[model samples]
Target: MTAMNTFENKRFLARIRGGDFAHPGEEEAIDLVLSHVKPQPRETVLDAGCGLGATADAIGKKTGAVVVGVDLDAESVRHANATYRDFQFIPGDVTKLGELALPKMDVIYAFNSLYACPDLDACFASFNEVANPGARIGVFDYIAYDAGALAATGCLPPSVHSMTQMRQLPERQGWACTGIVNLDLAYAAWYARFLARMDENREMLAAVRSPEVFEAVRKRYADMLHCLEQGTLGGALHLYARA
Candidate 1:
């Protein structure tokens, strides 16, 4: 990835941690991920891009599994480590998982992480490095392109893979889709909450985002709200894939 891309990932991670779009309730998406992964006491798990270590903490505490979360942002790593004592949070690049000194994991959760990875092949292969045979890989994220407004976010370029393309690409990387769940209601609820948050902190939001960028984001949100109200766009997809 380019340096600019790496920087963009960091900015995106910050937005996630700030609860602008990634609210506390986004844990519901993670809940869907954990539901498919029945962890054993001795199992090791990895939560890639684990902002604030919320999912990692839940999984680690619940299953008594050794969970290690990785993220490219030092702030996120620091935040996660400072907040969650039981789960380990490492500052590392998801694109280079082999260099992270992580153990083989029985399961890897990539909730909202794959979208930031430009090289799908390399990103998926990185998961293979830390995954044991037959390991479960669960991901909960927005299926873009189909979500008209959601796709127009400035954080994401328009050239990336659509939701269908993302789903198909995993199979090519040696993963088999075990299950899929529709997350329209959750996404709609989150979007509503996000807009309200923006309203509550409009000045702060405007200070960080330029006028043009803010307008673009607003347009994207408007398109999403319209599609959401009309029930045309696909909301979100929770995938359980096995490596």
Candidate 2:
């Protein structure tokens, strides 16, 4: 239940913002989120645990929705606010979401945020509490076996998702699943591309990130490669629900 520290999270955030190793399928994943939302020009949206706010910015610009991005990472919040001024990046904890002065939201995007929280149910509950009834909720997460066995092999990060456990929780809380999209093929391709990019542009990557961060990321890529090779890992997932 240990949360990622500031330094580690910052390094991960940096790669997400500017690294040459972003998954190729990432854009498609975002598109899927947008497709589900179909936000109107005047709707209010919440990008819970928005990370760098890439998805939030995209939604805001595309639909003219008032998107509010929130994250527990202070550095990430700062970067999102500074980098995407059009969107409001608020510093807050998703596990304790009600304290923020957010408006009634039409959509809540838990993009890749569930796995990062120590207690998934608590996190979901917080989102449920803040959301308007019938509000749309979208979640994209890295799903894996216990302790992410496949990730240890090399090509992906060590991540896990109790999807079976998660799906039931939302329903128990009154949110029904509307869709579940499997991005395994897309994730595998992205991992390959990311590893190749690292191999092809080692010097450039080193220049963009600190030596320590570069080494850390290099290890992560190596781990992902190994996992893919072993076939122990399967996929990343996206789910849509309604409160």
Candidate 3:
């Protein structure tokens, strides 16, 4: 796996996400999770693979949940801790949550993060370990409708799974999938807006990022749009409960 720092610079991520996020429609996605999970005050919420702790901060503020953000990237964790003082950011791996000494959680979420995990079963097992009996697990991530086309584009991570696979993996690990929202249309719309924003600020982005980096970012968005249009790549919001 590539070091997080190599491809995920803070400034570039900020530009792409329009702030502290690293994914499209992150706030809206979090709202969806909030609706499904319905966290209460003093309940524990874990933001697995939390990049920069943006979602953790938002959830902590909105739902009054005791939010804890974890990521494998030490630098990202450091920056998250510095930027979001109200929430706790820990440098840890989602697949190894047992060693993190985290409290049992009422809700756990991953925003565009689970696709990068190489071992979905192990990751879900770890989630099961740290979750209360009735804990909710929400994941918003890319779903490859046509794996061949998605692989051809090479825009997404190697571990991107189809919707069926996603559901089955969690089910095998003691999670009962309650809902799966097909968000392909929403994702495409988000990509359209993202493309427009990128174009509007192309020069500004170019100025901050290296030529190679800027082009790579641009190509990634373009490829995602193309794949979505081709009916190959898409997104989904998955909701699950501990069985």
Candidate 4:
């Protein structure tokens, strides 16, 4: 367990998160994304950058939609398919989704995912290729308040756009901006709770993850919490529709 592995990050978070998702706000975040997307039973939902397929599984079970998940991580894709047998998990890049040749997606959502993607135009274009006309896309991830500050922490994923940059992306990519929810305060509170929980469960966490992993996580969370409190890091949910 001390060795570096593909699922180590996931395993570390799973121990702390107490849920299937690898994001802040955990189930609450999924509820927020679902409240807006509202995928019906008959609709085909695509989790564009699903990590380990938990969110997609939750989406399927909650909405009864046909869920298909895609991620660039082969290990996660395999784990997702094996763990959640009902859904299809494909190993593919969100920025090059057209090559996967997936069915026309009725709705696409990226929960705490997408911030790692440096290019949204290509990502959106690839999404357009597989998404049906009028398909909805929801992105719930980090918004760059200070890309440099956030990147230095190494706790969360890399984000390179501000709220203004994010807002302009949809129309530039031929989609309409439907809604935006600023989650700065929510994320700050979440990180505070996260750090507290980590401290409370230090002994148990040490047993679950190796010493190296434990220290790595502890340092990252501390730095992340500092950034969040300083208003140098933020989060948001951006919704869009094909036009």
Task: State TM-scores per candidate.
Answer: 0.75, 0.83, 0.95, 0.92
* lDDT: worst 10-residue window of model 2: 16-25
Q: After superposition, how far is residue 184 of candidate 4 from its true place, in Å?
A: 1.0
Off by over 4 Å in 3: 1-7
Model 2 lDDT on a 0 to 1 scale: 0.67
Q: What is residue 120's positional error in candidate 3, in angstroms?
A: 0.8
Give the number of the best model, judged by lDDT: 3
After superposition, the stretches of candidate 1 with alpha carbons farther than 4 Å from their true spots are 1-24, 147-155, 197-235, 238-243
| List of clashing residue pairs for candidate 1 | none
TM-score of 4: 0.92
lDDT of 4: 0.82
- Top candidate, metric TM-score: 3
Tens digits of per-residue lDDT for model 4, 185-233: 9988887888888888988898886676788777877877788788888
lDDT of each: 0.66, 0.67, 0.84, 0.82
| Candidate 3 global CA lDDT score | 0.84
Give the alpha carbon lDDT tens digit for every residue of 1-243 in model 1.
122234343354236336311322465555666677777797998988776676788778878889999988787678778878877899988879999899998888776666667676776778888889868877666556454454443434443446676677777788776777777677677667656665676666566856555555555555555555555443454454664
Reference-based lDDT, residue 22, model 3 = 81
lDDT per residue for candidate 3 within 54-164, as digits (tens), equals 889999999888999999888889989999999999999999999998999999989888888878999999998799988998898889899988988778766888888
What range of 10 consecutive residues in model 3 has the weakest lDDT sum?
Answer: 1-10
Angstrom error at residue 186, model 2: 0.8
Q: What ranges in model 2 sit over 4 Å off?
A: 1-24, 146-159, 210-212, 228-231
Which RMSD values do the candidates have, in order?
A: 4.6, 3.5, 1.8, 2.4
